[model samples]
Target: MSLPRQSISPLRQRMLEDMTLRKLSDKTQSAYVRAVRGFAGYLRRPPDTASAEDLRRYQLHLVETGVSPMSVNAAITGLKFFFEVTVERADALAKMSPVRVPHRLPVVLSREEVARLIECAGNDKYRAALSVAYGAGLRTSEVVGLKIGDIDSQRMVLRVDQGKGHRDRFAMLSPVLLQTLRVWWRTAHAQGKLLDGGWLFPGMNRVNPLTPRQLNRAIHAAAQAAGIDKRVSMHTLRHSFATHLLEQKVDIRVIQVLLGHKKLETTALYAQVATEILRQVISPLEGLPPG
Candidate 1:
């Protein structure tokens, strides 16, 4: 059973107001609140009264408790915002430091694996959704957030509004993906599961869009059904898309723009996982002649 939610304290109320004034996204606001709440629970008192030493100890506590580096860093960021912005106690977090998160290459699926995965989806809706994720390199949220009118066949682009970083951009819409979407649309319309100009992927109720969690579950089931061994998620499709494009000799800058990445370095990471490009490289041993 879920525990009863504690009533919001005045300090937390102020923090919420500060976050709202900054126009932080709802997800970010919730994360910040959760981080502060966790900190307060650790202290058994209000977070506003924390000292620099307390902050340091709390960080150490997080590390000792086996929090992942990424989550620990996120908590540190949230606490920094609370102290620096809301509490006006910037010095309180002086001794607290964020942990460095190790960089690891993302998991990518092969083209054939991707095809089999999509084909194994429980239904046509999931199959089309999976296709859009790979075909346009869209995130799962973007896939479910797509609106019927977002498909711009005339311009051959998909209008992605408020994607990651709260930025709007266009994604490539291939002929194959368009046809797949049309088929899904027709099927959904015939089943009365579609609302005009509504979500491309709807939940059981047409009023709500398909959730990221639901899409994630669908992908897991599909992956198991396809008998693919590599870790697969909706994001695996996106990684495969970018890697395949790189293997096809698509410009890194072009892929960056298509992926809506703010930095070229972010898109460049895909090159490390592009097996085809790796295969095409001439080894120094080959130039030295076989022993």
Candidate 2:
């Protein structure tokens, strides 16, 4: 007996193709597709049959189920795009109200804690990665995507190409980090590895290089070894870098440029986390006798 032929759904296939054709980053494509797929699963049917009422029910379900406000907001955005852009059902999704979330302060690490984490790295790979992260204030993705050519030793600057927002900029390259990178390069060369391609810290895949997840895992392991009690991640390194620099009296505008933030307000948020500023503040009740 002949087996029945499997078929691909037009909607899903179209979504995949659209994602590819737009040249969206793999991470973003995965997130967008997952959010939309979650909506489909919630409806218990194809997304085409979902109405604004269905979407509202899903939103309520998310809140009652204790989903993060960010996740819930992302789901709504995904469904709205699907309905409006792909399905041509704009007005229905547009009428839905958005959930509001209060802005919370970001977690930051102290410079001493950052030093311990880097020092506790078990291997050269993790050490090198964290060194660049803290030394140059690089995002995890930026660190992984670094190329040998990006480091201009003569100028003492690391050229970050197509960072966060697809914009190019330069960051200070510390002398210590450069020396360590030289050692890494020699070790990589001796192994007959280190291809002359895009990435500096290439993954075992070699061609594609290491992922942000792998970097995160390395950081997590190092944090455990260092005995850090604070919740830490790859981004925590970035936060620490920024807050530490601000505490050291570096200009906030300089940090904004280094972090590639489009808005000054975004960089100003570090003020709350800068310990040095808090230390200098005067209390109204200081020098008073006990009541």
Candidate 3:
């Protein structure tokens, strides 16, 4: 017997087309679809039929259910797109507003902790991957998306194609990191796990690139093995990278460029967590004369 076929709803199809026309990334398209689907699940009807009051109530429900402010804001943006762009019913979003996300400092690991974490990774592949995340200050997605050709040993840079915001940029390729990658490449090549100009970090099958989820799991395992108590993720390495650079007296603008951040203020946030920089500061009280 043949399995039954699942069909896409016309509404969803239309939304997908709209997203594609706007050149939204696949990740973003998926998030928008999920947001609309969640709203439909709550409404018990088609999202297109949602009214202004219904939208308000749905947001209230999300808040009452303890959804994070960032997630709630994401949901709001998705719903706004659905109504304003897909269904042409912008009026329905009149009462809906995005929640204010609280600003929190990013968690960073000490240099020693980072060393221990990398050493504890399960295998060479993960160890090298984690090193790239810290050494080059790349996001997890950028690390996994790397290909053999993206590395420019001659130029001493790594080409990041289509990073966040769908923009292409180059990241630093430290001599140390280049060596780590070369070692990993030689090992994987000897095992016939690498293809010509293929993914730098391939999955078990060697066909697909290593996914963010897999990398995340590896970092968690490595952190546990290293006896690190602070909450750690792939981004933690990135935060540490920027913070360490700031502590070493690198210009904030330079760090901003290296991190591919658009705003200087966004990169300035690292100043708040750079303990070494803070230690170097002379307190105002210290400059004051004794009474």
Candidate 4:
């Protein structure tokens, strides 16, 4: 007699185990799960039973249905990982392809614009949070994940734990930012939010850290108040930080370490947006004597 089968498929269980073994981030794991679920829902059956033709057809359907290329690519990546790594059927999914996304320069706010944005934060907590984003070039998640103890006042360094790729790095803390944090800390401490060590910027529920959505909304509202036209977000602050540093003549290699970029090329992109650097360079036209 055959051994009893479980309600959950062995294939899916193994896929989850594979992801966990690889130590993927929680966000990445969630995205993979959602992508696989979408595939299964599209097929109206178990994803394990998908044939090569079925995969191609589903991909075509996604494009025909006007799904964004980035999203389509994410779904494809999930399926590829599930089949190639988890199910060990790499040959069957060999035809899978990723969408080629166009490269675009990141948005960089002017120093004045960044100042206005921070000034419009309304409250000291948000002001300090915005300052950290621009001052340290941190991601939204990283900014929200900050703990009170991460600030090293004496050494003037902020310890970032489990950043992207699960790597730890120290970001520079400016004198101005230190003062801002001190004020924010004083307020939080008085409110009993930081009686013990906790989130530097707590959410409505002080037990947990502030949510990304709320932080994003605060940034948006501040931008609106500042009367800036270009679309800006927490990421824009990071981009501006890199570009501003490049403008200041800071080496690209150093920026790479601060941003935790795996590749130097990734950090070099900021050179294109370093407006001040472009301005200061002697134009070849200026070098030429009157023609």
Candidate 5:
């Protein structure tokens, strides 16, 4: 009998296995795959066939197409990983360089806006989800990936597992957040859901958790319903959480731990966007009399 042909290309399979071995996040793995596919599409050949010149030309093409430097940089990083790590082609990656990202403060909603937005969620389930997002500063993935076991009612803490960089941490479980979660949990359980240590916010099929797209849409709808337009997303709740806490005189270190930021400077960025801090400042211009 003839040997069977593999459905997946050998290169692609190996790349995936390499990423899995390194324990790269699925998001990062997908980005790397997409970057490799884009490269292949550009050259009309397999990514393995890309030479250093081809990589340079692709970088030029990206910039010429008016792609943001940050996006271009991310694509370059992905391509670097796919070629250097997956394809064992370090020389090909040398010609590809990342663009510098300009520093910008994160967008943050005021405390009142956060409250109104959460209140405007169309239903209890969405409302509770959004509340947890803001109340605990959990990322969209973290919020949707929550398991029932992650909630420590007795300890008054929320367990966040495998957050950014695959790190685990704990967030405070405020009485209000705990109450809202209990309500949603009771309803879900009464309806014969929450099966087999299922996702706290199960998706339609009830096997997978709610997708990020759905969570993003809910946030957008809530922002619109609340009549607040600030380019908000699920992550905006996280920004608001940190900013609001900073405004409340919470320590930057505490906020850093809560947001699961690896660097204190990352948490310190919120200070730049905290309006309360700005409001308390007396400008030197105030010294100019009646200008």
Candidate 6:
């Protein structure tokens, strides 16, 4: 009798298990899985049968189909993991180079634009949430993960524990943010959402942090009401904070530390996109009047 065949590849299942074992972020795991699945679906066969030629064709298809470079790179990364970890065939992937993506500057709001976004918030909770995103240069996740104890008012520092890469860091606290937080705290306390040791922004569960999806929705609604042209998110506030700081001549290294970037290259990109820097440069054609 023939042995039973499984539907999903065991190797792919193992990869998922490995990601969990390593404590990888859920977002990363989901992305990796989706990318890998895309490759598998294209081949219509198991990943073990996929070849360099197959990958090459996929790259061409992505470009021809007008797929963004970012998405293409993600597929390449997922394939690399399958070959390197599961199949133990790193040599097969050595010659492959992912398409080079042009550096796209992040979309950041002006100070006035940020204020307009905050003013559009219908509720105090969302306004306070966004204020923290701007005031501390915090990611949405960090803002939601905050606890009452994280606010060090005396020292004027906010402690961020085990953020990206499971590392801890401190961010400067703005008096304006602190005052808003105090008011929000009182409100949460009245709602019985603030526990002795729990998330500052609680959701359905008292101890768990507020969901990122909820924050994203609130930001989108606020942006729409504010009549801002640019796309905005909780992350946009952070980008605005960094870009504004770079405009003020703050060093890239300092920005890196504050933004919790592990690489200088990551932080350097903001310098290329700072509005103030762009504004200061006199266009080469400015001296020549239009004919």
Top-TM-score structure, candidate number: 3
**Candidate RMSDs in order:** 2.4, 3.9, 2.5, 3.9, 3.3, 4.6
Candidate 2 lDDT trough over 10 residues, lowest sum: 1-10
For candidate 3, write residues 223-271 as lDDT tens digits. Answer: 9999999999999999999999999999999999999999999999999
Task: Report clashes for each candidate as comma-separated counts.
Answer: 0, 2, 0, 0, 0, 0
Ranked by TM-score, top first: 3, 1, 4, 5, 2, 6
Q: What TM-score, to 2 decimals, does candidate 2 have?
A: 0.90
TM-score of each: 0.96, 0.90, 0.97, 0.93, 0.93, 0.86
What range of 10 consecutive residues in model 5 has the weakest lDDT sum? 1-10
lDDT of 2 by residue, 183-287 (tens): 777787677558875567888866777789999988899899999988899888888889999988999999999888999999999999898889999887896
* C-alpha positional error of residue 277 in candidate 6 after TM-score superposition, expressed in Å: 5.1
Candidate lDDT values, in order: 0.93, 0.82, 0.95, 0.89, 0.88, 0.84
lDDT of 6: 0.84
Report the poorest 10 consecutive residues by lDDT, candidate 6.
1-10
**What is candidate 1's CA lDDT for residue 226?**
96
lDDT of prediction 2:
0.82
Ranking by lDDT: 3, 1, 4, 5, 6, 2
lDDT by residue for model 5 over 176-216, one digit each (tens)? Answer: 99999999889888887677677888887788888999999
Clashing pairs in 6: none
**Where is the poorest 10-residue window by lDDT in model 3?**
1-10
